[model samples]
Target: MIWLLDLDNTLVGRDDAFALWAADAVARAGGSGDDLAAIVAADGGGFARKTDVARVIADRLGWEADLPAVVERFRAGILAHVRAYPGVPALLDGLRAEGDRVVVVTNGTSAQQRGKIARCALAPHVDAVVVSEEEGAAKPDPRLLEVALGRVGADGADRRDVWMVGDALHADVAAGRAAGVRTGWVSHGRDAGDGPAPDVVGRTVHDVVAAVRALAAPAGPAPARP
Candidate 1:
């Protein structure tokens, strides 16, 4: 089986490095501890400068703008907080043990995403790392999935043979469905959804791993909302 996993909130909970940087930026910008957060919420640029979250922070602080320099600092915080969610490593290892090919389908730029992978030590276990920054598009985009499939050779296979696991319905689940792959949602350790549901759901990475190990393959149900 080939697994395309999400990073933030999926592998690691959404206690973002951007949020931490925003906290510090807020203080540096002469605002309250929460002041810079508005920019981060509005901007999604990690270290790649997608939305320029740090630039917004600098602007809010009325400081001279420096995209390159601020990106480095912001990434430092992000890498520092690059802690994986509980049981993530176990699941990845288990999948490898099962002779599965695991590829990280994440969004962000070359530097930002690579930093996380390096800090998290993900390269050794996974087969490949695909990020939107390099692909020129983000998830839920079949183009990105196609590129990933080309990398891992998942083409001509049914959705049942592949599993797309993540925490976000709009992003990961939507991407899975778009790519015509099975879906397993790690719903923030709840492992269960109240309204709609996934083919298989896990509250944590470990539960998903258990489901994967028990099931014959990745034939999953539809996705539900939070």
Candidate 2:
């Protein structure tokens, strides 16, 4: 089986890292208590584009730094806190042990996403990684998933054996369904929401790991070969 995993908020706690980064950025700007909250709010929970976030910070704090400098600071801040969620490393290792291929499919700028993967020590665990900026297509777009499949040497013949595991229903889950592959959604304690339900739903990454293992189990010794 092939596993296509989502990077941010799935394997790693991107929101937690972003909060730490916002605090650090606020301190660096010599802003007060209220400023931190304001900055974090303006960040849109890290969903805002980096350039736009930088501009907002500069305008709000009266900073003279250019966009590039602001972006550099943002990346540095996030990199400093990059960490995988509990059980992620072991999960990847276990999948590899079972001879299952794993690919990271993410939607973000190459620099930012790569930084997270490298800083979090995730590169060695997966077979390949496909970033939206590098691939010219993001999640919810079947093309990006196709690129990931190709990197893992999977063709349409293997689609039935592929699974996309992610936290976002609209993006990751939708993309997998659109690509005609199975999807496992990491609900993270939220409702699964309105849409075609995912083939599997788990409240945590650890749970998802268990589900995948069950799916890939040996099928009772292949029915004793008849």
Candidate 3:
């Protein structure tokens, strides 16, 4: 199977890392805990535009730093704390070991996403990596997913043998649907709610790993060729 996974909030704890960064940034700016909470809330689980989030944080904390400086600080803070969720590395390694092609498809700047993959030690386990900025296409656009498929030499592979898994319903699931592949959504405990419904759902990536493996498993003995 060809597995296309999202980087942020899927394989790694991007929102959690941002929360940690927000807390520290708020405190350093002499803001209250409430201020920190507001900043995190404004992040909208990383769905919000980063620049918008930065503006909200700056306003809440009364930071005199310019927007670029604030965004740069966030970039640094995230790098310091971003890490793969427990068992993520093993999951990718296990998938690859079973002859599955695993690719990380993400919507972000090339440097930012690549840094997260490197920081989390995920580079070695993935068969290919596609960043939207580098590809000139982002999620919900079939091109990015196609680019990912081509990167791992799976462009001609059957869509039924491919799966796109991630936390975002609109981005990952929609992209998968657009690309004519199956989708597994990591809901992270949220309701599906008006987005493209997924073929499979899990609260986290670990929850879906078993299902993916089961589906990808070889049929029993090929029925002894009758």
Candidate 4:
């Protein structure tokens, strides 16, 4: 089995980091500056992809420094505030123990994703980390997910063995499903009103891991092949 994960609020709680950065950046942005509502709307209710948020905020603020640098500062702060959702490592380790492949497919600046992962000690468990800055595409697009699946050699015939778990309905669930990966939505108490959604719903990483464990069980029912 191969598992693809979405970082940010799925595995790493980033609401505080976003609130802090958005508050500062929007204030600096001036005219209409940064409307938290607008940014949140653009995120499609998921955690904002760091580069997307910074670029829009910078464009709105009219900042002159290199855009990457601007994004890096925001990401640095995100890393500082990163607290892994409980049971994340246990989940990852369990998958690995079952001889499953694990990959993290995130859409964000290279510096942003890696910075947070490095700080969070996520590297030891993840087999590959494919970030949009390097993959040349973002989530919900199927491009990065394809890359990760190809690298892991997860065939369409093995669709039941592939899973994409994340908190965002648009990016994680939609994208992962598009890429032929089974989807798991990690609901963090935020209601996702009516929308196209995930294959399974869970309250935390442990819940997600439980679902994964059940799916990967030798005698468990397999998801229809994609």
Q: Which is the leading candidate under TM-score?
A: 3
Q: Per-residue alpha-carbon lDDT of model 3 for 84-195, expressed as tens digits?
A: 9999999899989989999999999988899999999999999999999998999999899999999988889999989999999999999999999999999989999899
TM-scores of the candidates in the order shown: 0.76, 0.85, 0.93, 0.74
Error of 2 at 105 (Å): 0.9
Q: Is candidate 2 or candidate 4 better by TM-score?
A: 2
TM-score of 3: 0.93
How do the residues 1-226 of candidate 1 rate in per-residue lDDT, one tens digit apiece? Answer: 7888887767764456667766776776678645665667655433235337656666677666886676577667778776776667777887889888888888777887788888777788788888998999787776777677778886766667788887766677778888788888877655344533567788776777678667975668878878
Candidate 1 RMSD to the correct structure: 6.8
Q: Write the per-residue lDDT of candidate 4 for residues 66-178, one digit (tens) a residue.
A: 76786666666667777767777777887789788889888777877788888778889878888988978888898888888877776553776688888888778888878
Top model by lDDT, which number?
Answer: 3
lDDT of 3: 0.90
How many clashes show up per model? 4, 0, 0, 0
Instruction: Pull out the clashing pairs in model 3.
Output: none
Ranking by TM-score: 3, 2, 1, 4
Model 4 worst lDDT run, 10 consecutive residues: 39-48
lDDT of 3 at 13: 96
lDDT of 2 by residue, 118-147 (tens): 988999999999999998899899899999
Give residue 187's lDDT in candidate 1 (0 to 100): 74
Better of 1 and 4 by lDDT: 4
